[model samples]
Target: MKNRSFALSTALVCALTLAGCGVLPGGSQKTTVDVWLMQGSVSGEFLERFTSEYEKEHPSVELEVTFQQWTGIGKKVMAALESDDAPEVIEVGNTQVARYAESDALRDLTLESVRDLGSEEWLPGLAEPGSINGSQYGIPWYAANRVVIYNKDLFAAAGITEPPKDRAEWLEISEKLDGNGRQGIYLSGQDWYTLAGFVWDEGGELAVERGGNWEGALHTEAALRGMAFYQELQSHGDGPKDADEVTPPQAEVFAKGDVGQIIAVPSAVPAIEKANPALKGKLGFFPVPGKTLEAPGAVFIGGSDLIVPEKADHRAAAVEVVTALASERWQTELALTMNYVPNKTTLAGVIEGNEGTAAMAAGAARGRATPNSPQWAAVEADNPIKPYMTAVLQGQDPARAARAASERITAALRP
Candidate 1:
């Protein structure tokens, strides 16, 4: 059963004071709202400033912020949600909402979204997953996506003056850049997120809902074509066929200066430059080219979303904190400070003159997320996509491997 015993009281308070203030007898007791933010989501300076400003603005409320690690966070979140004292607000991955909401432990934020926040202005990639069955469970926050980070010296050395506008041209140029002990791109075989974008570009979904049941669609013809394209692209690079990008740290690999290109968030530039300072001025960025020149390739929108746990001790205060973080004022601050794309497309101009973010923002327009199945997280927990990709790259029959993977996905999606 859902733990909604606190819903009525919390919702009532939020409705009365959407500004985050709480009314106590004599206004003596302060409401301490605990927020769990993913580590590295924001710098210490931003968090300190936000906390100070928020406390100053809402004298009756106290903000207690905690940073969490990404590793094993899924399990931690599930356990936290089941606990009686879960943090009021949590920063979850944008794609993780459906799985978390399946527990019915998250507060329904539809009313807050429509009334206090500009729901219509939120980015589809972040907003769509946050909404489940016509109700808002997650509040969209800042977003980031993959862009083509290339070594300009490599491009110039290969006689390529401009970034490719389409996949065909991209592949053609990539093949040209693949020689001379340098890889054209450092795309790992198990980088399923990149493969997902290709699947989306080819009009294939990772999974589809049918009559209230979800099933994997990786075996579809269009999806196979996407896989074929991924294989083609992988061939132009020397990345490990069995490992994902992070296995060897793609940024460190790129910093080695032998690779011409990599698909990564623009934030990777700093790490790349820090690893090899000589390449500082030689880096360039462009949106991941699509199949056609009309648009950029669809990328997996990577970002955080704010959610209020149902059993939070201070629910109303939590909603206020979420509202404040997702507000335009803080969104702008976050985008500028963290080099992220703002939650709303209308706010794209805030990142103007920032080339890396601009490329990411251009692709963000066509970004996609993982399948919205509640069981999708379970699928990722024991993912079949990575193995299927490895098998195909290792000369296994693509159809057979895809079928095996799809069947596993279907089983995982089953409750």
Candidate 2:
């Protein structure tokens, strides 16, 4: 009798578990598409609205969106791909796109199916970074470029009349704006993005490719000159002494009316306005100053690119989403909502509705893409320029520091 009871109990438990499986009344489900994006100001409500609108047009598809912080996105993507659970669509930084493209993990969308939708309509220099070996592996959705952002009220209070038009004038203004518990300029001490701009402005190439060989150029005289110049500003109190106090949380320093000028990307404009609304009209922007007319100061171009993972189950659906994102209408909508510059040149007028967007777009037009090579990651991680910069800023000999930094960079690049 006990044996009979155990068998009955087992049958009952199996029945309960099967019943709890939970299926729709019709026993049918719509296909789900996965998308991964960075978690930030741009990913929240905007993505929800976009997905909702997209689903309405294609009733058979549902989107599952995952958000990750910018710092860990590359690792997350690689892990997802390795597990065969990769999202159909993913957002990658512009600087990182080349590395992924070379890995063969991204789908090549250069074929007629997607290209027929008008790939050439994108801005000339904007989408070039997403193209590798003549095949377009990704689409540029939004872009940001660095610009000279100044506190006009602080300048007026300091008795400065105009924005600097050249490198010498820029230094002069920085010196004049120093003292009185105010900084003449502010820059993140360890930010490669900001440092790259000054390097290019000094005629330094981050890297150069010859006959399929990549050489690190950061150890050159040009790069050292740029680093020394940056250090000089810090040593003279024209810039921040500690790199930690140069960015974001410390960005409030400007809002407190303690800094005269900074070079930052367009996304920071909204934050600046939010921190001090009264300074709205007081903020002004201009192209980064250069040493000569022929050598305009360089601005780093950083933004997101959309890629379809190789292991994704829904290639056709992914292609449709990519096409939609690259559409002029979609690009314009994204620009207006996110303050990102559209990749399409024809849609430039969409940003013209506001002065801030207009200025940002103009700056992005002349911006330069980071070097397109797999070795860039290593170069960026181990570069000695930052420490050398700190030494220069502390009043070390400029010429000597530049030479030393150059030698170190060269040694790092040796095969």
Candidate 3:
């Protein structure tokens, strides 16, 4: 905690010195919004452009933007929230929203400057995670959801014309592709993100609350059924069963053309094209298949949220920054630049030229955020559910492993 605190102190030192009493042309103090955003979520060029555009739009304001690494951002933000020199605005992970909002570390968006933010524009599920009681503490930023990214050449070779539409189709297609010295879909042993999608589509949950207490829901009938499907897929799919799956850069891995498909976010498209240029024409995407072959399943929504600290000296300026960032033009720029799922439903159709973009937009429409429990962070950090999935894949009884994992999860959820 102290390390994170010291880091923010060092960051604030740089921010203040660089500003050094930056003021407006009329000799009035220019409100500076100290903004902290995640490193990989948006590119540097985009950030620079945003700053320039924002300053152009609001001459009385300045945005001191800083990019932070994602490794332990939650801890750093929490630590900084206690300091007198905390950033006015922050880009927080969606999962960390409940924890921060519940602790009262953030400003309620109901405040006058931000109250008309038009919450309906954001994907409802993405907004749910950041709502404390009835007011929003954080606003949805860019998002990425899992989709079936496949090598078109591999699909063609396996006599597959279209992407799988249901569980049965996926199994058949995977089996067909996994032969002649090639692998089918690459499934990770410890990837809770993808597996949880299957659970959700099959009417399962990773955790549930009852009697005002939260506990692991993996042992439920629906969850177990979902887990059984995952177990069979892992055991029979083309990947290491005893260890987490390791592959080359997504494009390079798919470039081999033998590794048929994998679950990934739409943002990988640019990197894939850069890593293996030859795959430019051979790659495609579709929403993850559901229990019913006719439709796509619920995807796990992962993204950053913009929040203003309750103690921010320039709260109005920070809220304006949030408004600008979530605007239609900026969101569209994010989609074109990073392949991110835009926060607005009106912007969804703007990304529909390719199947990859279409899949992402469709996935966003049905995205499901994880349960809103601050303790859920501790549970995720402990990684108690992964071993259960691994055990089931290694031939252990699924029910027994789930039971043990559930016990550990219940303990973690307890305050």
Q: Pick the candidate with the highest lDDT.
A: 1
lDDT of 3 by residue, 259-292 (tens): 7887787666677778777778777898887778
lDDT of 1 by residue, 314-394 (tens): 898899999999999999999999999999888999998899999999999888889888889889889999999999999
lDDT for 180 in candidate 3 is 83
lDDT tens readout by residue for model 2, 1-415: 0112112332343365553322222544455677776776364566767777887998777666766777866777777766676779888887787778766888888883244556776654457778888888778778877777788887898788887777788888888888888888876565556667678778886666767766556667787676766655544344444454344554476666678877776556677778988777788876677666544466677788888988898977987887787677788788888878888656778988765566667656656676677556666677666666666666777567656765655444444
State model 1's lDDT: 0.90
Clashing pairs in 2: none
User: After best superposition, candidate 3 residue 283: deviation in angstroms?
Assistant: 1.4
Q: Compared to the true structure, candidate 3 yields what TM-score? A: 0.89
* Residue 395 in candidate 3, Cα distance off native in Å: 1.5
TM-score of each prediction: 0.90, 0.79, 0.89
lDDT of 3: 0.78
lDDT order of candidates, top first: 1, 3, 2
At residue 171, candidate 2 shows an lDDT of 85
